[model samples]
Target chain A: MEVKGFWHWVRHTLRLFALYGKMDTLGLMRSMGMLLTMMLSDTVLNIAAVMGMLLLAERFGGIGNWSKYQVLFLLGYGGLVDGIINVFFGYNVAFISRRLGRGQFDHTLIQPQPIVVSLLTEGFNPAFGLPSLLPGTVLLGIALPHLVLPQIAGWWFLFAINMVASVAVVLAFQFAFGSLAFRAPRATEEISSSTMHLLMQLKSFPLDGLGAVLTGSLLTAVPVGGVAWLPCRALLGMGGGVTSYWLTPLLSMVLALVAVVTFWKGLQYYGRVGSQRYSNFGHRN
Target chain B: MAVMSAAGFMGDNALFLIDYLLRFLRVILFFALWRLILHGKGAINGYTLSTTLTYTLISEVFREVMECRTWLESGFWDGSVSMRYLRPMSVFAQYAAEWSGGVAFRLLTFSIPLLLLSSLMGVNPLPASPQAGILFLASLLLAVFVGLGIEYLFSGLAIAFRTHPWIFNRMRAAIGEILSGALLPFAFMPLGLGKIFSYLPFAGQASTPLSIYVGQADSPRLMALQLFWGVVLWLIAGRLWEKNKEKVVAYGG
Candidate 1:
């Protein structure tokens, strides 16, 4: 019964996405332009960041015991996770707060499907995500050979699993942050944006030196480190033991569970308070 | 204006505090990374660890002032430009005033305290000389003007391409950060490459001012270049605004 319901939601979401795609006459051209622009800018930025890291790496010869190529692998892994998140959740996530704030969320609540499912499919734009994923895949390809990992087939399997776990970690963040709209809808957008920026910066660097508290937070609560650092470390056969290899996937699962529960509670809260006020743009009194 | 100033002040200080906390964490993280890279070496690329740390902290401090998207992007997208058009003042002037107010409040509430905290922690670097200090102030004013001009061009582009103002916003941020040397010091690059980047208008924003403070570049020449770009970019921005204003008017906005 549950499997059937899930399939039904997936079919409904795809139909809605196809309908929207058909309605936009300029969608193809605009999407192409956006994809090209994003790819170019993203590539340049990634190259620059790698160059900066390389310069520092040359000076110091790598962070702790990790070599430059190993760090590059980590950077590539970060890009992969970032690409996946942007492709899947980027567009709809931006509107979630505004919809919740303006009483527009009521529309989604009235849908036959779950609110989370509806929100996820609201503005699913694959074009935006595909271009971003290209660079990540390229970077990963370049760095994979240099990494002293297991056999290629085994490493690829681990990488695939890690990537899926990373997606779960990222989705947990999106859902947790998006739930802020239920309370302070007016401020959630800025708060969400700033939090993401902070997380992005943290994930890009090696956090091993920040002592245990932060290192622990990034591993457990925030899990930005779980997406890239820990997974990369595990893949490289550095630091963590056999049991530690399972830590990120485990953490990812737990965080996703927390995200679902938190968002459910937020929905309950919204039903109680958010329905009482119709706070449209400029109409919030 | 008063309400805007108050709101801007409260909002920025609150957000600034949160951002500042994150920045402090970054500072600590980078400090350790640099230490590992330096490996007890005094400097890399002629920048001592202290000087480089100072540059990072100072740049983070002035980031908001160097940022110009608050008004232009928001006003154009939300149809608030129509309201601004109904007023007597030019839209640019209005934005400039609002930006300046926000910057002033930020400097008071955010930059000063952070500078004090950093200095107390012995990470902040003082100006090399009184001449450097004087030049740094001049460069900051020019940086603000350069930022205004760049934002004016962005606003013009937003009006011209109404559908994807977010794309322009992202481009402005990414390009602006790279060219302006906010992401990493241009000095970290090779000398020839750094010299080339210095010639661009975006370098005048944060790079030129901070470089002047640290006595890295020739002060007179850098300030002169900043002044030149400030005038040139503003003129181009004015022209772009004139050409694109009709689009907004046509939309009955």
Candidate 2:
């Protein structure tokens, strides 16, 4: 009587998990491990960057206005959020779409549950978990004591929001690539490859290094800057003297939700167009 | 009669081959021009757009000339070689000959177009010193062997696991891009990471050759280090191949 719709979705989501058996469970662990290793490498890479910053500090005292601790703090904050997104969303949907293009996707689709959940559940890369989470956790520990408790809590909230939004952006990008399967099967592979190459170039460095205009554009249009830079700035009190002081966890949540909505809408379009198309290896125009 | 016809054709139609080669060069030139314009002159990852454009062109040539016809795993996964069992030639010898033939064909065919493109674009040729040139040449050959060995190692997975392992291969490549300094120059990466990367086999394929050419190696000692890894990988690949040969699942066509 109270709420029928809410319970139904919860049941569907729970039922989705119930479909997995032993092999899928192993795949999931493998995916987790793989992701974890990659994240650990990333974190180690970030730590290496921190040392570079320390060297820069030795030479010039500081970069722009931020101290070495501030930079490391930002690096830690960004690394953690970045790891979470890659571990969860980086491989799941993107890898699924590629498999679908290769006809391996039929294996997951034939299952009795929701195809997406089965996909997400089945391809668990064990490396995925530690490679992402460890860097964030370690950096967070190192950076935590430097900030005020409330500020640290606020930063943590921002980190969660950033993770969600980044994952959504990646999902949207994947959906866009997935939609290509309807017209051109090879296009999905091409698009995903090119996008990964471009993404590494985009986010490997801080948005601040890109300067004001690009940073502003990133925050407003792409929202990558918002996910890491703007939130980090707000947490550390780096820039936007007036606006930075007021940037709250609530604002980050709102932006992240908006991005998710955009991504979901894109995914719906992919699902609608994709299921209707017929592609066999031998037949072509 | 076949040998006579081949000699006659080569003697009679050198101009036709040149004409076709010129047409192909023109098409590649136009495509590269379009890509360079669209990328915006902005530098990302220490490569100025111009340098990146040049790198892309060179890499394309290298990729075309050096990449094997099939990824090493293909022999295991696709059942392409069941026919080879019926053939008179040794399977290993057949593959090796084809690999060399394909690479040689690509290098011979692609060299002219690549040279013209580089000259037209005013991209400088890699280091001019005799010693450096010799070392660079050595590194490139070593890179090919190491790359081949890695390919075999990855391909061996298909024999053992009964899966294509393409995802693992891609992951390996991504890891290499970072650790091997193929995408971003190793020197530009954080120094601690660079030291760690210097020890990895992935860099021995792409970065070591490129670095030797670009004069990025610390000394001749570093060149020797790369050669050491190449040998190590070659040995490992041989072991992996021996192990995998027993498990080769030969399905009937």
Candidate 3:
């Protein structure tokens, strides 16, 4: 009875925390603003680019043996997935790294809460979703009918795999950045900015378009390619076999396991190395 | 006397040119170190290393040349504008002169070296045409004006929001960076989506000019649309400034 009660409380607390997280005012406002701006920018540029290219493609009679709609369909779904990630999971790695490096992790240690739960829930960046992505979601819904339903369901499953992968890989990135903060806090800031910049700039394009060598490296090594492209191919009912459909999620699970293990190892190193408390104005602990 | 005056003018021009060249060179070196991490590998949203870096270098030059610092907090707290308004010169004109000086300093120092490096890296800077060059310069100048105007106007939010102006400013900056085509090239998105982005001022700031120079835009008609949006944003900024002028506090520093 005691153990069952404890389990029930845990479940109740998780639900309550998630509910409160959704109510975060500042985060939501900021998200709204971001969504508005990104939507405006993305909407205009994407339309102009696709239509312009399609017109050209029509004249030239399609490049790479794909129809204009096929490419549009590819981009539309790719963008939908991209938008979801940017809205929800974008902050996870950066926030974790910043907190970990600052030894702000200690603050959470004193609380009677789970460390991971606190890290995810402590500060909400609602602005990631409200105005910006809300509209983008509408745009995405409009684009959705263009995709077949069963494939869309499959894509959702892939999205689930991608989310797990995101947590894993992003945790790795955070651990790597945070670990550097022990030696140099400012360095993490630089890394964060550049990584964010690179992801924003690079992730939208078709990975395969860059050709085989680069795509192969990204797929096997970094693995950002798997998040969208793998699922996208599955959704399109293309060359991706049943094996390919399962491949990304399987990889995601393995990567998550590896990342957690790596992070644990990194934590052990941190204990041994013992980070210094950076002081202001030449002050010392 | 006329010949001597002409020689003097030429000397001043040369000095200004040299200053600009030197600043451009320094910035280029800084950027080269910054971008060295990428090592020109990997594609960003369909832009190759060559195209991406070239676009980046151009945009960086525009940003550095046009940046106006302390437009928000200073205007609210320091009474800096009070002094400027009392003077004979128009505040806008004075600021424009400062912008010109900075631009001059950047062109000679940073831009030339970056141009050289990009050329060596096989990155063609822009399509070679007098008309294109003129259009590009004009659009960039308009962007600076629009950007500064917007910054200054929003900086006034410091009066109302108090102590949290930095938050708003950062938010604004982040949104602007993404919207402005600084984050990703505008060319690579879906057609419907790209249409929406082009309507926003961000594309007008970076993407449109770059696209025009790169021959990515369909026609001069699109360039005209870019100009139209720049004007509209400027007008919007002016309106916002007028609406918020009364909220300005004369807090002493």
Runs in model 1 with CA error above 4 Å?
A: A1-7, A10-26, A30-64, A94-98, A275-285, B8-20, B119-122, B158-163, B190-192, B249-253
Residues A157-226 of candidate 2 have per-residue lDDT tens digits of: 5555545555545444445444444334443433444443333233423455544764565554444454
- TM-scores for every candidate against the unseen true structure: 0.87, 0.60, 0.58
From the highest lDDT down, the ranking of the candidates is 1, 2, 3
> Candidates 1 and 2: which is better by lDDT?
1
| Residue A222 of model 2, lDDT score | 41
Ten-residue stretch with the least lDDT total in model 2 chain B: B1-10
What's candidate 2's i-RMS value? 13.1
Better of 2 and 3 by TM-score: 2
Writing each residue's lDDT as its tens digit, candidate 1 over A195-271 gives 56666666767766657886887677666787788888888888556665677788889988887888888889987
- lDDT of model 1, residue B201: 88
DockQ, prediction 2: 0.07
DockQ for all models: 0.34, 0.07, 0.06
Query: What does candidate 1 score on TM?
Result: 0.87
Give me the runs in candidate 3 sitting further than 4 Å from their true place: A1-19, A22-94, A101-103, A120-140, A148-159, A166-179, A220-222, A254-258, A265-285, B1-122, B126-142, B157-204, B207-253
Q: Report how far off residue A176 is in candidate 3 (Å).
A: 3.9
